[model samples]
Target: MQNNKSAARQYVCKRRSDKMKITVRVKPNAKKDHIEAEREGEYIAQIKAAPAEGKANNALIKLLAAHFDIARSRIKIISGFSSRNKIIEIIYTRKQ
Candidate 1:
């Protein structure tokens, strides 16, 4: 029983690690809000909000969540919180 529990924990950890990381180049204060896939694991986001008081970041998160069809909470800014270029992590579980 102990071994089974340990194996289950390991499996959960491994499953949680099955997430995707992407690089995003954000353009704040654009005319429109949109997201374009530059290549695999890279994106260009044009946001309408200005880069002030985390508004642009929040807008970016909303846009990405809509594009990916996931909750905004599932997306995290792993780096570059104060820059245009940011690294984002998306947590998702594979549907089976």
Candidate 2:
């Protein structure tokens, strides 16, 4: 069945655990500052900030750093600009 094949593919994908890539949906032109993760979607993050002069991007980095308990340098904007949707790459590094 198609459903079974999809499930099997997903299972195989989950088993191969590697670097994680997260996607976030930013809400620009917000009144206050806040960041919240979506309940249903683990990769989806709701950010409250205006998309102006990379302000939203900066806020996203700071907010994600706090959320993941990682340093700001670990979070990198891999792609997506001039749009509400952004793809962020979280790089993990061992402490020296």
Q: What's every prediction's RMSD, in angstroms?
A: 12.7, 7.5
Each prediction's whole-model lDDT (CA):
0.81, 0.62
For model 1, the superposed segments whose C-alpha errors exceed 4 Å read 1-17
Alpha-carbon TM-score of each model against the true structure: 0.80, 0.65
Model 1 lDDT tens row, 1-96: 011122211111112465888878899999999998765667779999999999999999999999999999999998889999888989986787
CA shift of 46, model 1, Å: 0.1
* Model 1: worst 10 consecutive residues (lDDT sum): 1-10
lDDT for model 1: 0.81
Which pairs clash in model 2? Answer: none
